[model samples]
Target: MQLKELSGQSGVSAASIKYYLREGLLPAGETVHATRAQYSAKHVERLELIQALRRIVGLNIEQIRGLLKMADDGAPRLTVLAAVQRVVLHLDTAAASGDRPTPAADAVVRLRNWPDYPSDARNALNVHLELMESLHIPVTRELLDTYSKAMDDVAGLDIAVTTAPDSVDQLILTAAVGMHMHSQLLLKLLALAQASHAIRRYEEDA
Candidate 1:
């Protein structure tokens, strides 16, 4: 495909594609002639991913470049995942090394017995646990176990999409952006469920 075809297929403007090329975000196509270059489906995929990262994930060009660079350099998926979690979007992935993990957080880890839980995620969960504790809300092992079971399914969905991705960059960015968008949907579902349960309980009590 030509550049114009790529732009049309990608739904990105030719000017913008040129800008991405200039910024080294999109690799140049094969030079088929003095004035023509050939592109392929890979270019389309990159452009779409780039657009998603920019418009959906809200990552700036430099961060996207860095993330893409790690993949291009043949970094492993875990390394890319860590970089995205820690350095890319600042979306729930920041934690200091010396910070303490709450008891509930540690318990959740022990129940799972899983190594490689991201520290920032544990810290994020700790914040919720502490808040509930302060509010005199009980967080029991049974509750955590149930929630953990539910999230295991969610994790499966999360991982399943990125499992066969073409590259580490594709996998991480796809997961990151998809998680960002679906997180809102998940919260909305939770709220609706809570509202329905509250209504049901109130009617029963009445």
Candidate 2:
């Protein structure tokens, strides 16, 4: 495919594609002439991944660059996956500063008994707990337990989806897109559930 065809197929503009090529985000296609080049399915796939990272996953160019480097580094599949998860999670150690929510959060984790869970996930929970505290919201054990159970279900579903038998590229693509989609799905589901409950509780006898 030519540049125009590549752009059409990738849904990226030719100008943007050229910019990605220049920025090393997308590798150059085969040279057919001094000014003409031929792109292949590989180019299309790479462009999709780049687009997914940039538009869906909300990564900056530098973050995408670093992630691409990790993907191409010949690391073990699971190791590469961990890096991808960290990126998707936007894990920030700095956000977890001050009094750690470890003891409280770890109590929930231990209750859930989720083995092999990353510590950064714990940190993320602590960050949220800290925020809730700052807002002067009560952080009850019962609330943590209920939320942990719900999150465990969500995390299980996500793990099942991402760990399905698929190519590395497919798994990476899913990780980039799935999390955002799942968040939206949860919001919609909550709205529907709330509406149903309201109708049941408030609607008059018909």
How many steric overlaps are in each model, in order? 0, 0
Q: After superposition, how far is residue 98 of candidate 2 from its true place, in Å?
A: 7.5
The TM-score obtained by model 2 is 0.79
> How much does candidate 1 score in TM-score?
0.80
For each of the candidates, the C-alpha root-mean-square deviation to the true structure, in angstroms, is 3.1, 3.3
Model 1, position 122: C-alpha lDDT score: 63
- How close to the true structure is residue 94 of candidate 1, measured as C-alpha lDDT? 38
- For model 2, residues 148-177, the per-residue Cα lDDT tens digits are 899889978997887674556666788767
Q: Give all candidates' CA lDDT scores.
A: 0.78, 0.78
